[model samples]
Target: MWRRRTLPAVVALLGVSGLGLITVGVTADPARPPRPPVDAPTRTHPAPDLAPLPRAAPVRVQIPAIGVRAEVVPVGADAAGVLEVPPLDRPTLAGWYRHGVSPGETGNAVVVGHVDSPAGPAVFFDLGRLRAGQEIQITRADARVTTFTVDGVRSYPKEHFPTTLVYGPSDIAGLRLITCGGRFDAGTGNYVDNIVVFATRTA
Candidate 1:
């Protein structure tokens, strides 16, 4: 979904794939640790000391291959762990990852946006269509655009989300872009799966 952060992950609060649905509080205990991915790599990173995100107006998101561009909004979390989503300010960016890591930082940079809103199409609705080697760029307040490349994309059932793969500590710079996918359930009103894209930074 072109986002990575704890608040953004809160998007899952909307619900998950029908059969795989497992809300953090309702179905599963939030205290329970998320399952790690199989054959997941070990954390060899010395732990990158990170530079804080610039404070100012929010930034813009751009994907050259898809011809998609929009301004990103910063959101935080509530007492329940659900992140905030931005109001439709003209195809603008919304949502936050209040708990988890931010993009371009250490660990998994999680970003999530609406697949679609009732009123109109939302940003990241077409993110699932991105292919490997595609690039995603973000322009921060410094007026500098950071470039990222998609390395791979995978979908997982909600019941069996790879917690480690999605949230585990990393040894290098990494990313995980997530969104609902698979058959849209008519009853639950959410997708039957989540699409996660693994990416790395280029510059």
Candidate 2:
């Protein structure tokens, strides 16, 4: 969980999340999706212009503590800020959360990853094992890499996610990870809990 005694200078960042888990369906639901948390931070840069990252496949993902080393890819969002996840063709591995908040200027940045897919597993399968003070490295489009340190991990019921804690405000550069968890509700086809990991930029 993230705690900010006060808000600090913000920075460039975005939120990533998978949609609520669901059972394989023979039909589609027509209702609009839920609104993202209103407290999410927003990026103010003009050049990126909310453009999509090149479709180039990711080369690697690094976590110094739990031995996570995998490739990643760029996911985009609609006007609402809800982002897309991995496997553009498959719904299981995809995650999107635009309203949660961006890493406003120079504080904690939030991104959500997926745990598994109906086909098998996904990017954040081991997220539950992450601890405080670990390292996270992301290689960006320019080939420049960014590093962050894990502070802690927390799980919350989706219905009771800590809006203030996840998107409220912060005084330092950080990261928050989210994925589905808890009892599987076969009825609605969703997890009751959301795993959240807090990370901080180190370099």
Candidate 3:
């Protein structure tokens, strides 16, 4: 039977299989505080009056500020009920939670990628560098390009990861880009924080 575990625990479990390379330490710091949260603003510009897509899956995601352009793959929960991430081997790929709303739909669409891999920096390596007003573009299977403007970027301790806020329902189309960031815990082999970019659809 599947068991419920904190996101960090699940990440640690996955780390055992090398996926933790996303948060593994490149440099060590033992003086890091036990609870650290990086919170970004939640302000957004007015959205354009564009018609929403009719349930088509996203094909690609592009973030110009960070130079990330990659194919999007659908992912679901694993046998243990933990959310599955993209394979470590294909570090350039991004995964969209299959159970969530599609990018152009009227809800929160989540896309997650690794900040780095064992080989080096990955697709979302610079995700935390994104600033408010940055653009995030997603191409749908129907050939429509949906654009989202960054509202803010925040990093929260994994233990206090705001699952509901990140995955919550939205009246308008929204997008969330997630990756590991903040201080790396060499002892645990995982990042102490999760960097989240909140954006709202503009076109």
Candidate 4:
């Protein structure tokens, strides 16, 4: 079980300050995703701006570039309003925020997974290695596949996590894959940073 704590920044993102936070408890040092090198070349492409699809829960996520194809389970906030995560024992599963827009919808759909577990690197362990132009395919409960193109990958410290940018409403359908990264803080038993992949729906 992950040790729960109040993510004040998250609460702020929800416009409900001090209400609740999200899960933040990684026990051991796992492999962290590489940060984007400042000198690395970047690509620029016109927004695909695909029309949003009807609401449908995401059941699976596949990233061929990173060799990720994991089951996605819905996760909602607890009674105290704290956002929940996938079962700690099920590190290969990804957790989708049920309250938010589903993938292919006209909003930011957020998904999170464990970078690694006690056993070894888990789902999303190679999230940082993904580059622009790659594709992410999400299978929705409606039996439709929603495709998204990688826009960018970024890493941020937990303290300065961009809650709004990751979870905020948007005109275009967007996807954010989040996982813990950076140095593990022995004091808190948590990763010091978060790796976020920003992608926009293409089909």
**lDDT per prediction?**
0.54, 0.48, 0.73, 0.74
Candidate 3 residue lDDT tens string, 38-138? 55557668867767678988889998887888999997666554567788788899988777789989888888887766666777878877888899999
Q: Against the true structure, what is each candidate's TM-score?
A: 0.67, 0.60, 0.82, 0.83
Regions of candidate 3 where Cα sits further than 4 Å from its true position: 1-39
Task: List residue ranges in candidate 2 displaced over 4 A.
Answer: 1-18, 21-60, 74-83, 88-105
Candidate 1 per-residue C-alpha lDDT over 89-149 given as tens digits, one digit per residue, 9 for 90 to 100: 4334634343555555555666656554444445665666677777888666667665667
Candidate 2, residues 78-166: lDDT per residue as tens digits? 34433345552353342323223333234444555555555444566567676665677755445656666666666666666655666
Between which residue pairs do clashes occur in model 3?
none
Cα displacement (Å) at residue 83, model 4: 2.3
lDDT tens digits, residues 1-203, model 4? 22223344333433221111222345555555566433332334566747779999999999999899999999866655555678767889998888778998898898888777777787887888889989999999999998988888887766666677777668989898887777766666666677778888888
Alpha-carbon RMSD to native, per candidate: 9.1, 11.3, 5.3, 5.4
Q: By TM-score, how accurate is candidate 3?
A: 0.82
Give the higher-TM-score candidate: 3 or 4: 4
Which 10-residue window of candidate 2 scores lowest in summed lDDT?
Answer: 7-16
